[model samples]
Target: MDANGGIEIERKFDVDELAVLPPLIDLPGVQAIAEPVVHDLEAVYFDTNDLVLSAARITLRRRTGGDDAGWHLKLPQNAGRRREIHAPLGRDRQGEADAVPESLAQLVRVYVRAAPLVPVARLTTIRVVHALIGAGGETLAVLCDDRVQAERLVHEPASAAWREWEFELVDAPEDLLDAGQAVLAVAGILVSGHASKLARALGDRLTAESPRNRQRPTPTGPAGNVLLASLGEQIGVIRAQDPRIRQHTLGSVHAMRVALRRLRSVLATYRSLVDPTVVQHLRTELGWLAAVLGGSRDEEVLQRRLAGLLDREDPAVLLGSIRDRLTTRSAADAATARHTLVVALDSHRYFRLLDALDALAASPPFTATAGQDARVVVPALVTKEWKKLRRAVRRATGTVPGPERDLALHEVRKRAKRLRYAAETAHPLNPKRAARVSGFAQKLQTILGDQHDSVIARERLLRRGGVDAYLRGENTFSYGRLHALEQQKAADAEALFWKAWSHRP
Candidate 1:
């Protein structure tokens, strides 16, 4: 699925400008080498004046003359790999600064906010491609030797020329990248110091403008550093999920909401390390975003779960328009919810929230405790979360099976989740038994989450199936049966939660 969006898993090397090429078809996993093909490609890269995309290891460009020439957005996926998205050149063939494809722009909206994406660099490449074929005549990889002319789009617009070799995997395993790198390394070729063409093209100008290289104040204490790093990771996850959500990718909305919750949980758990007012504001905004995503996600979940339940039910009990009402109403509700979610995602308010989050990641407001030794302070924070979880669990278990208990169990699930996140953040330098607590919290969380889902399902069946279908004169027998099943599922989940909690570490 990750590769469905054209993930580029490749390795690159900088070869001497006039260096002779190495032997053609001798690398590992190569059965034959296809005839060489040449392409003269011209590209223009875009970014803010401050090089926001470049700083984040992202590149957006419009190119012509290549077989796949169009608008390309290359985003960092992992080490030595990028998720490349391609869209038509559309109206920006002449390289209009503000004419970036809206589809691509939305993916980077969190970064560029209101900033214009102007031409930052231009590249013209004379690329000779050699395809390395593997078992069963599969094209394992493409090797390109590119002689390039790059011009920095600045006040003076400096130009540089160089030649480099690119080995990109097609139908090859990740080990192929390392294998090819080894083959190239033996021939006096090393990995390129520059990360990409845009990075190389910008030259020292990139270093001068990129915020990543700029010096900052003294580093925070260990505990503060750990918390901030966790926060940054969650922020990265949210940003990465943005395009997936826009594309209606399954589980993206839920993944994004989880990231938001983790971010808020970190701030709340480590409140003593940061300024109260600022942390509170960030948490409020994160909650707002999560709620907005939850609306669409909950609807979709209900519809899907009900559909699955219907599939397993006996045909004899299925009566009236119950399935139709469920399908029709849920579909409409999910669509409306999705529309609202998209609007919220594109709103100025959401952009401002993103800005706040970025600011928080860049430089957080720290209190005196932030300077303390993490060994002494971090344990207490995790302990606090655990204690809260214990209290919630006790209250929830003591309550009778009713709405109040359902609410209490939900509270327990939230607390357990917070503990799980805090312990995970502290897992790296763990000394406070974080692993044990995290294991217990994770199991408890899963059990309780199932119960909460059943709670929601029951309510949905009552409202959508019971009342709505009743008003329409459709027999409500199926709704009653489904509702009873949901009730039993909730009871069974609660029993599992208590049994698991008893032996929790």
Candidate 2:
């Protein structure tokens, strides 16, 4: 059973007393599904250039004798969160590590650094599973019982060993979780307190005990280092989002692009804080990743909007093959962009760039401009962003309130969003002021974003009629109506932006 496009919701609990229900597999009202038992399974995880990925807070593993056995790459999509990808095991557990296959390796290029893939650890789990189902016979959740053990570097002497229970939920409701927990509470069976057992087990590699988690890097002189560190973290975020975007995860592409823009925005806003050469190089790479992924993301956004429009359109008004032509063209363009993204991720240059980024992050090249504290540092950043916004607004202001104005305003809106985020981060000094700025920036951005989306949709509609026959099907009316509505929507938003920005912050 391959699962895709399904939402995975997981919640963890703390377990205390285990002396509860005599290892029973059946509930009081339910039949005994299977006798309570535990089975041992061994797995060896692999990674490139060494165990560096583990440092990035991710794990790639190949396991045997497990209920689900395969090559698993548990990528860290966010803090305390992961997206697991499982591939079937090879014919034999041999010859599996073949240069970290480009498709997969590209997903983790930011962390692996071109390192040759190798086995780093062996984990053995003694476990039991209970499957819960709903009234309609749909599987809900799988409760796992486990005793875990680990040996570092399967071939070498053991370096790490630990034990813990792991609970992974399936298609269960939130309320049922509360009910189950209450049952466990009454039985004196509690949940595990650890956020993740892997973190506890690989403490040495992860610096799990380090104070660095909460401690912001000690600010040197003017806070230049702080800016660089922020930029680096954003870069990491963009790279981490790559795999999710490829999988067409909702909002993933937009998020990654935002990170890129933020990084670029930082450079533009704080030009005096760092060397221009460094900023230029990073910007180049950022542009490259963005351009590569742009097609897929843009198509996705347009397609989603077009579909909605098609749903509402009067069937008769739709023109010749409009929707079909656009759909085909978009799919082809999206595929090409995806390929380029994957290839770029696998390139040696990309790896080299990541390594350089790591080094820069660990120790940024700070100039004298960094000595200022938040009050001084922030105003400069915000001012720079404001100037960029101002220029874009000015460019957009004189244009006829049409597509060109809409597009230019959209760019300005983006600048406003970044500036707003930067301002929000600086709220500690003045909460009310930050709150006001964020609110204003948001309204402008929303209007601009909607307008830009409309423009794109209209262009797509025009192309659809000009091209493919597939789009000429029963849904053509939707495109024309949508295009007209979007045009009106953009005009309305522009009016809103002017009304709001008129009162300066």
Candidate 3:
């Protein structure tokens, strides 16, 4: 059997109802039971040298328990989602107690700070399971009554806490929670305060992992060598989200996109730190990934914006089948776009790109900028970014306020964003100056962001113009309207850009 199960939904609730006055009386066919048996569980968790699992907010444990128990590796599958893998007892969840599993440890190889996985903490849970099934006999909820004991890292003295819950799941028509809640309400049972007993027990320890501290030392020797350390972190994020995105495990696409953008942004920001040729190669691949995913995101944004616009207008002035037409075409486009993203992810090129990036991160080819110590080097970096912004503003000012001007300003906006991120990364050394540069870069980016959104909206319409005519039986009138609005926004952005640019030092 597969050790890993796909994403599982786990929820918890309080048992105060039966504990307090007026015990659960509802349920025409059911009788009430006061006491139930609970068993104590003990588990020690481990992670790789870099704490990959923890950095990804995943927890792995080896536990001795009540009914269903074994070595468990719980990996994150998006917000409030997790994939639990079970292995036979006596061995570490990853393989051995002292050493990390090669397969799992490979994932964190880039940040191998510590030598081996160590005992982080121990958790003991007293669990009670209640069967809530219907006459046709399907389980609706598993009411679990729990009391927990926790010990800090390396088998320190233990701590204890008591709690109870009803874990609701989907096996019936209505929400299992509603029926269970209705019964528990009469008994004065309230939902659990913490999301999970483990979460509550860990307290501050849950928030211990930080990526920066986990980073491997910058490979060194000579000056002018640029380190792409940040890119490795970004790639790690992308890989971590891949399986979740495949599962459509909520917010996966957005998270993946953010990771890609951060990697691309790092390339753009630290152009002087690393090899431009390599950066260019990486950017092209990143652009392809972004474009593949951008279609769905763009349509999502347009549908939302257009619907908001139509909502404010008189229903009569809406003209044509705007909502239906957009929805029909958008759904088709979204499906195609999703397929493209999946295929691209599976391609050999993508893997090659990842391999290349990992190599670069490990031993970056830094330029002259890398030679200077962070203290002497950072301000000059800030100044270089300021210069780029100044050049963009200059190019944009002389041009007439139109499509050409909009495009130019958008380019400037891109530069500003790159500078802002670079400044943020350098902020540890010179907090005050870095903050000022970041703030100004942000204002410039905002102006450009509005303009760029308009530009993309127009590009999307042009691409969809033909498809809209064939499917919706129209010449893309709605798209045209959106394009016009976007152009106007671009015009408006020119005024805003100049106003914002003038304020920057």
Candidate 4:
């Protein structure tokens, strides 16, 4: 969900042609009903050739003839919730056609990659609305009795008509939905089987719209199925976080990067299950994407870290304008980094990479070993990853407190993350053991991750304290103090990591 997105909480019911509108004043907490208002609404739904968006339970439409008329992108959330994003139906370059807004289109690029969007369904809704006013005169909800005429534009055109009621909350208590449903049930109006009017219009055709067009992963089946499942979940996170990154949502960049890294780790850890050639390509491209998201996130983290350090320092030790300088530099770097990330996301390379991922999800390139039993295959893979982390830890423990130790700890952190993901993928086979292993692996990753962050922080502090401060003619003393503080932080993380490792099973 982005800036234009909001949660849509509504309950819809199917009714007879002559279903009478129930008495509203008698419903719980209702004080009055505003006079009915009528509006004729039209919505044109769009999707790819195979109805990819439909398969994903997403709907994108260019709608007209309502108080709110534009483009609507509806994405499924929780069982009773849908996240709806609105974008103005902007004009074509020559005003010849109504083009989908870029803001909305970009959000769905992961699902719609390399496929053209065409009209799939058209719906005409004649809606009569009655506002359900609360005792305080607040419009808690609105009830719309709709007479819908739907026409399927794709694959053997068809039409259908129906009457339905939409009970949507405005500012009402969400439990009001249960009450409204009970009322509609009493009126002998059952909940609509259709998820949306478009689904109803498409009717029989929707049952035919199955994700079976893509392969389903099963734990008892191909070993590659497990890898694909893991890969698919991470891919979804990467896609879901795209718009959040655009909105500059807190921690979004880190989330996207972590997903990208997880995908790479899965490919690397399960190298025997997938084609080496395809795995290399995906791992390389995923690394590229992660790098693109990393710049801004690093600056954001450093800014916070430095700010926290400064806050804890004695007021008298604070140098002249040091805080302002840090703020200005960080802000400028973040802007540049954010712009670069946006451009990269919108680039043809990124889109092509997404297309490749979609293709991979639909039909992963599996190797001969992929057909083995997961119970045997998964444990071996998990053990292999654990050994890698163990080796890295041994090396880090052997090193003294120097640059070599810092580098070794960073390597250990990366391996720990790999082991954690591998253990997670192995969970279906042995939940108890997988959980225990994953727990220890994550503890290692977290503390070592902090150590890695401190390592980078020290390098950054050196540059800022030496070159930047020298050039700006600011006090260098505070920078040295902060550098020393970061070093201590790194030592603390190392100690914690060792303590956790000593107790590992």
**Clashes per model (N, Cα, C within 3 A):** 0, 19, 7, 0
lDDT of 4: 0.84
Tens digit of per-residue lDDT, candidate 1, span 52-112? 7887889999889868878888888877689898887678577654488888988887778
Model 4 bad stretches (over 4 Å) = 1-5, 88-93, 114-118, 154-157, 203-222
TM-score of each: 0.91, 0.73, 0.58, 0.91
lDDT of 4 at 168: 89
Instruction: Evaluate residue 368 in candidate 1 and report its C-alpha lDDT on the 0 to 100 scale.
Output: 81
Candidate 2 local lDDT, 406-480, one digit each (tens): 667878877888777766554555678778877778778786777778777777665654343334344545555
Q: Supply candidate 1's per-residue lDDT for 190.
A: 92
**lDDT (C-alpha) at residue 302 in model 1:** 83
Candidate 3 accuracy as lDDT: 0.63
Give the candidate order by descending lDDT: 1, 4, 3, 2
Candidate 1 differs from the real structure by a C-alpha RMSD in angstroms, to one decimal, of: 3.4
Please, what are the lDDT tens digits per residue for candidate 4 over residues 1-505? 2347588888888888888987777778889999999999999999886787887778899888867788899887877788898987668787844567778877787678667788899899999999999989988889999999989999899998999999988877887777888887887888888788887887776754323224344457667778877877887888788877876788889999999989999889999988799889989999998898888888888888888888999979887677887888889998999999999988888888887887787777788898887877888999999889889988887998889999898999899899999998877677899999999999888998888888887887789887789788888888888889899999999899888889989
lDDT, model 2, position 62? 67
Show where candidate 1 strays beyond 4 Å: 1-5, 29-32, 92-98, 133-138, 174-179, 208-221
**TM-score for candidate 2:** 0.73
After TM-score superposition, the amount by which residue 475's alpha carbon in candidate 1 deviates from its true location, in angstroms, is: 1.2
Residue runs of model 3 more than 4 Å from their true location after superposition? 1-73, 76-229, 275-280, 365-371, 458-484
User: Comparing candidate 3 with candidate 4, which one achieves the higher lDDT?
Assistant: 4
